[model samples]
Target chain A: MSKEEKRLEILTAAMRIMHQEGFEGFKMEDIAKEAGVGKGTIYEYFESKNDLFLEMLRFSTEQFITGLENSLATGTDLESKISNLSLFGSKFLSSHLNLVNSNISHLSLPEDSKDQIKRYWEHIYKTIESELAKAIEGGEIKPHIDLKMAASVIIGSLNQYAFKKLYGTGLPPEQIDHQAIARMILQGMQK
Target chain B: MSKEEKRLEILTAAMRIMHQEGFEGFKMEDIAKEAGVGKGTIYEYFESKNDLFLEMLRFSTEQFITGLENSLATGTDLESKISNLSLFGSKFLSSHLNLVNSNISHLSLPEDSKDQIKRYWEHIYKTIESELAKAIEGGEIKPHIDLKMAASVIIGSLNQYAFKKLYGTGLPPEQIDHQAIARMILQGMQK
Candidate 1:
């Protein structure tokens, strides 16, 4: 594999260990084994375990942003856009939210991570806010509906429903009816 | 004050310590000082520091369940019910969610705590599910909408919107347009 691909492989492996074992439980050797890399090779990708932990946060955030942008891009209108986002949210949250939240709240993280988390939230919030604005311009929904509230509704619905599914015995992410949710959200916001 | 009132006061005090200082950071004397009670008085209510800690979880969860029930009780119909719930959630989650989640995930918590959390979730889920079921029976919404999905949407929306307010620069909970959010959610679910 290419160097970049291999680097990502190690990161993913590190995330797995962290996800399963938390911040202090795993070792470098554990990550190396999980990644199918030699011990020394793991060192080449991340300077230290702390580095790998921080990178995991960055990697997860970056992955989410990319997924979020892509999710919003494919739809021509609000309903389809929300549907795609719902699907992405359901899939992405169950797999990665635990990793993200755990790392963000762990004491070992620096103050910078809190700012990163805040900025990450703001970035997603703004991205969705603009998407909603565009939808309003397109006459997909009511003109005067509070855009910030609308954005919160959309983001919140995805987060809570995904969390519910994760915590409760319910449909897997793939089986969730995203279109229904999207339709429900849009139907409410429409004039 | 009455005995029950004093007991609750102590629990609230313990929660403050736990909330500000985390699981390990506070002492019994600190809690007593926070509560304006003798340190010996704390032991009269709780067996030990661990007991106080565990009670904080139970106390917080019980408080949430009570608030949730009362919030739903004031509304005679679906729209009013959802609006009331939204207001309560936006206010309560900002204060209690971090504590509940931190305690639920803390290493010192026993496996039994996991069961309690699950039961707590299921209780709220069923409570809201039944409330929605009543709404459908009353013809406030469509008969054929997926009730489980509907329930998830409501719960998820409240959770997420509240979280957004907690993390972002936005309206304080009291100022949030809970009615708007309620309308949006119900509008989508209605026939």
Candidate 2:
């Protein structure tokens, strides 16, 4: 495998271990075993457990962002773009519920790791903000609407729904109507 | 002081300590001192630190709910009622950022305590859901709108904005326009 492919393989293995064993129970050796790689090979890619976990977070975040970009490219209008983005977000959040929960509960993670995660969130927010700006420029949404607040609200509401589905006895993630949610947000934003 | 007043005093003191020192650094002795009560006096009301913390959570939740109920009572129309509730929610959340963050990070808190907190969230969601139902019946909001999802989105969006104001350095909590947020949500929910 290519070096980049090998790194991706390691991250995938690490995510599985995190989901199965949680952050407290995570062990590097177990991850190596899961990935069919030697312990030394894992170390060569990551300096420590924390390093590996941070990389996994970054990898997942980048993957989601790429997916969102792809969705945006295919969507022709403001509502379609937002609907696609929300759907992607819902799927990503539901699938990574364990990782999100672990991040919430494991407050002892290093400051740098937390900062990195925060930066990733900011990136997502910026992406949404840019989309909203495009809608406004296209005269699809009201110019008076606060893009920053609008972006946060859209992302946050979708996250809340995804969270309820994942952790609460609410609708299953697949059953949620992403189009309906997008329509609601569009109604709120449109002139 | 009356019994109820004394209990409120203790809870207020506990909340202050939790905010200032966080959950990990909280101690009953310090709370007692802050409340100007004997250490044993605190035990008379709460069985232990965990009990006291849970009670604090319950106490705050009740106070916010009471405020929301009052808001609902005074508003003459559906839009006014929702605006009042959203404003109350935004103010309450902005003021209680520390408590919220502590709850998110302090996963070591007992399972029952966590469960109790979750129950409190459900209670709040139900309150919003009932209000939405009232609006639907009055033809103020669309009947087809899902009350559960609508409530979650309203509360979740307000929460997301409050969080950004509290932590994002974008705006101070006091500067956030609660009414604008309420108006946006009302637009989305209105028939």
User: Fnat of each prediction?
Assistant: 0.39, 0.26
Cα lDDT tens digits for candidate 1, B68-139: 899889998788888898888777765553554322342334678667777887787788888877777787
Tell the DockQ for candidate 1.
0.32
DockQ of 2: 0.25
Q: Write the per-residue lDDT of candidate 2 for residues A79-156, one digit (tens) a residue.
A: 788678767776776555234322231234567876777777777778878887887888887787877778767766
- TM-score of every prediction relative to native: 0.79, 0.73
lDDT tens digits by residue: candidate 2, B1-191 = 99988988998989877766653457888999999999999988888877887787777777777977887887887667766766676577655523432224123456777677677767777887887777777777777776667776776677676666655655665677777776776674222
Q: What is the number of backbone collisions in each predicted candidate, taken in the order shown?
A: 0, 0
